[model samples]
Target chain A: MKAFKESILCAGHGGQGIVSMGKLLAYAGMQAGYQVTFFPSYGAEVRGGTAHSMVRIQYPEAIANPVITHPTVAIIMNKPSLDKFLGRIAPGGVLLYDAAAAEKIPEKTGVTIKKIPCTAIALKLKDKRVANMAALGSLSKIKGLFSLQELIQCLPFIFSGKQDLIEKNTEALRQGFNEV
Target chain B: MTPAKKILITGNEACGEGAVTAGCGFYAGYPITPQNELTAYMSKRMDECGRVFIQSESELAAINMVLGASLTGERAMTTSSSPGISLMQEGISYLAGCQLPAVIVNVMRGGPGLGNIAASQADYFQATKGGGHGDYNMVILAPAGVQEMFECTYEAFDIAERYRNPVMILSDGIIGQMMEPIEVRYPQKSVDPDKSPWALRGCKGRESRSIRSLFLKEGALEEWNRDLQRKFRTMEAKEVRYETYKTGGARLIFVAYGTSARICRAVVDKLRQEGVKAGLFRPVSLWPFPYKKLKGLDKGTTVFFDVEMSAGQMLYDVRLAVADDSRVLFHGRMGGGVPEEADIINIAKKAVKRK
Candidate 1:
């Protein structure tokens, strides 16, 4: 396959596992033989404030400039994130957002928008914290960049020793994937 | 040769792993933002490896502990951010003066005093120049990527031992917090304190020795200073390291280091696509400065554009190396602001289009 690059941005309020979602994506990309970089916003705002992470994956080549000014894919998990990063998506890029949290999303020219009901799906799984994973599931389904199995395999490493949480998160990911 | 297994890790963790792989037996550090991951990694990793890890009460104590460990001939290290590194300057001077082999990792944050936890190259002057009070120079290595973070730190120990001087791995918050895939590798031989002649290993079988920087005797201090200067001159001649990207027959070169260098590389790629002959000159060893190589790159027509996260700290060195102020231009962002690729591209375009 020809070398391809994807710059992804995951943004949400703190405690929503936005950084974890970005790590999962980058780890999956690395597993698929792609050079990847995951950069998280490190500041006092890490607690109950706006948080975001940037992940760039390039196949068969190293990634330069890990910071994404214009993202190829923006995963906005809440209203604040949608409001902040909506206009920064590249033309012809994909925006997968939480439909229940980010209400009345604005339309952007030349951008593909997929409104995934991420929070509602996580609520159905009996845990609303997995909303980031649900949104990530929709992202994978939309982009087809990494398979569901690849993402699932990363759970054991990311959420080590949390067997029950892993099971629920896996189900949440599957629900989000099937919903898309 | 066995192929190393690639693992996903943050820059901070990678530096810790590098130190561990280089047979670092002693690590002492205080918790600081951006660089806290390294201390945390060492806490667990050192325990697993049956080594020593200390969460010192302060940066002052931490650096002194490293000095103690180095005196005992253990491969030792300490890490911190900008302000914390400032606190350890006195200890650094002591290490340099005593001719000790030790590694210091500075994951620089924006700073004049207790600056916010944001990525900045503002500490370039502090790292390359003598941050502490002395006529001492520490070998400074600035790694631009996650893999180099590991590799540079791993090599820093050898460089320190080779020169019997303090060596610094000067990194920033961006590289510290960012995560990338890296293949970890170990050195062939671990550090053996008994092999060092100056090591204070009980001194039972050998004559008693002493290691101190305080020279109260007349002319003794001057003689020691001369020896230190000679070592520094030898380091300047032998230890300069840098990387050149696409500079072959290029009309413009971006001189940058660390995180800014990576962004400049992206700018070079974009400019090349636009038919502009742009390249990058990244100084891996900030102390040695690569003066001769930088001067050699000037063909009278090539304009050297220097970029940094600071307000042109390294620009002075570039100007001094090039010897002509007209041939050097600078673009920088201070107080934790990072220069974007678009801005650099615009600046480069204007520079290339100028008469």
Candidate 2:
């Protein structure tokens, strides 16, 4: 396999598990024997506030900078995040967003935009909060950076002792991956 | 020897773990933004190790608690952000004057006066220049990544005890909150307070010993000051730690520390890839700064570019080291603004062109 390097940004409302998704991605990257850094930014409010995280994964070479200005991939879950971060994506980058929030995504020349009804999919799985996980699953399919199984293995670690939540999230991941 | 295990952790928590692994017997800290996680981590981990952890009522209480603990020769520590650290300056001075072995972790944020809860290097002067009233110096270590946060804090205790003086781990909010993988290693032996001969355990078997900074007799205070100055000189001579990247034949060098240095490292790689011979000089120990090492890297033809998150607080030291104001250039962002790689690259390219 060629050396891998990727900078991913996950952004949405505070209650949407945006930070959790970023952590899961970073943990999976570490498990795959890659160097990873995860940086989170949010307001004082624990819910309903804007939140985002930057995750960088690199192999063989050390990652020098933790803050990602122009992400290669972006997972946007709400309208505010989509509007704020869509134009910041690198040229030829991939953007995975929630269809519910991105009604008028402008066309970009080299970027690929995939709109998945992440919240709707999570509702089908009986927990709309896993919308972030669904979006992460779509990212996995688009980039093929890590297998769905790899992400599932990280569930127990992140949500330890919460078996029901883990099962529901695993299902949500599978659904999103299949949809993509 | 036991092998180190890889784990993902934030810089704040890593420093806490470093303290615990180094046999920190007591911890006292008040909650503050960008550094509250460290206090929380200690509340749990310190208890697990059968050590003492206190959520002090205020920053004043915390530092005094640490001082009390250190007087008994216990490995003691306290952590805080910019405003909180400012509140602890008086106690830090006393720690230095009394010649106590203690560690202080400053997870710095935007400063001057309750600036903001964002990453910053504004405390550079306060940390290295003896922020308190009297004359004293603290060994300051700047760690740029999560791994270094752990390693630096782990070694800080030993460095403090070696000189019987206080040591400070100067970090920023960015490093404090960012999570990365690090190898966690435990020390072979924990610190034992009983081994310290000067500890005021009691006057059971021998005459009592006293520790104080109040030397008010005729010329008595002068003798104490001389002793402190000698210790500072010895530290400057023996404890200068730094790292240089691709400076062998570079025409331009970026001098930075902490988060700014991390960004400069990437800029160096990008500049080199574009056929520009750029290098980086990062001072890991900020107090006993690697001044000689930095000055030696100056070839008469090279341009030294200084980058920081403050309004050139460290620039003064850089100029002093190079000994030439005209040979150095500065690029900085203040009030929680961080220096970006692209802007640094642009500035460095222009400098190279002019050179």
Candidate 3:
């Protein structure tokens, strides 16, 4: 096998915290001292429209052009975003979308697709906003690229001492673990 | 230096932190999508750090403010995305002409216009090809994750000082929102603005030096360009950085950078499992592209797939390095759509079967 860098893409609506998920992954890479880059999209209409974020994580010496032309893994929170972006999935990429909100999966392709009820799982934890975090938890377990410990360490900064929010978000993530 | 511990912070926060760590005392910017967090974060922390955080009247004013601060030998920074960045180009070029060192961060999004707030790499040409005017290049650093945001932010400042030139941290929306653990280093080595030979201060002790890119003398302007070229050549040789993924024993190679490379890594793993050989080539530094490093690779006549978010700018460099025809292919998702791993695997398998 060849030595290669790992990249991740998180796409959804403006308020979906799609960019936050990418930030956590990039944070993990940066902590390891690997070269990491994060970029999120912005436009006037994104507030009510679909939005996405891309993160590139690689060795210090092995990165070029901080743009992701193709993604290996995608975590989609909304159906519109899924419909819009599903066609770009690489042959062996992992596609994880929210089944609870999506009416149906985008047919079938060569990619490894997983439809999880992220919002439902977050609902069980008493907050649907953490749905993005739930999806992140599932990604770590299935891909085995990131670990629970890393995600846990990241939670504090994300919630920023909001104990109640942290506790609930953590629960939502754990629920996602079981569901995935 | 050993690797630092990872922390979860948005790309905007990382940029602001990078400035703080880099001894930046002034920050000027306007509110723009995907990048509002940078200035917002600065507003919250700059005062505590005794830094000047200014929300200028416009993007133009913001960049000029940074220019003003940088002239006084203070480490200065500003950030914006696509449209806003476009507005600041004039100031950036002027700063370059004056040989001012300042760091600018661009959290790019889809565009020619308002485009979309979705993460996109459409600005590759703008950053590398000189967005403003004339023959000038900004030291562009593309960060695929949070740590790079922090590290590159600091490095941009360092490079700016070293070359007495404007440096750009060319990033996109995804990087701006990412949160990762980072080992922050407040590097030592401060510049004394008063000591600079050409800074505008009041000329209390010596002959006043006027900073301008324009010289009424015809030959003088040409000489300035020559000097810039010499400096750029030095940068190209000393600053190129890239990563090679599974180039050994592979008949197909996928070249991607930033976030796209992450997916490519997964694609490589899946292809290996399927008994197909595929690899990746990534360039970390944009300006001083790692051309020689790529040219030296032995692909055994493998096919090269240049993937990007734009139509293809980096592909031009790949072509230049390979210096061959019919061996290189292009794959990309324009606007704001990002390709998934399965798409990559399918492409790799097809390439393998074709060979």
Whole-model alpha-carbon lDDT for candidate 1: 0.91
Candidate 1 per-residue lDDT, tens place, B1-355, comes to 2224789999999999999999999999999898888999999999999999999999999999999999999999999999999999999999999999999999999878988888999998888889999899989999998899999999999999999999999999999999998987666348789988789988887899999999999999999999999999999999999999999988999999999998999999999999999999999999998999998899988899999999889999999988888878899998889999999999889988993
Query: In model 2, what lDDT does residue A172 have?
Result: 88
Model 1, span A1-180: residue lDDT tens:
678889999998898899999999988887777889999994475768889999999876678798899999999887878888988899999999888766677789999999999999999988989998898788778899988888998987789759998998899899989998
Candidate 1 similarity to native, TM-score = 0.98
Model 2: per-residue Cα lDDT at residue B275: 98
lDDT of 2 by residue, A1-180 (tens): 468788999999899998899999998888888889999988766599999999999886889989899999999999999889988999989999998886768988789989998999999888889988888788889999999999999998678759999999998899899997
Tens digit of per-residue lDDT, candidate 2, span B1-355? 2223679889999999999888899999999988988999999999998999999999999999999999998999999999999999999999999999899999998877999888999999999998987989989999999989999999999999999999999999999999998888666347778778668888787888999989989999899999999999999998899999999998999999999998999999999999999999999999998889998998887889999999998899999999988879899988888899899999899888987
Model 3 Cα lDDT, one tens digit per residue, A90-136: 67789888887586775656788888889888777767789998898
Model 3: residues with Cα > 4 Å off, grouped in runs: A1-158, A162-180, B1-5, B185-191, B298-300
Off by over 4 Å in 1: B1-4
Lowest summed lDDT window (length 10), candidate 3 chain B: B1-10
Q: How close to the true structure is residue A151 of candidate 3, measured as C-alpha lDDT?
A: 77
**Selected candidate, larger lDDT, 2 vs 3:** 2
Interface RMSD of each: 3.7, 4.3, 6.3
lDDT (C-alpha) at residue B188 in model 1: 37
Candidate 2: the clashing residue pairs are: none
- Which DockQ values do the candidates obtain, in the order shown? 0.60, 0.58, 0.23
Error of 3 at A34 (Å): 15
Alpha-carbon local distance difference test for all models: 0.91, 0.91, 0.78
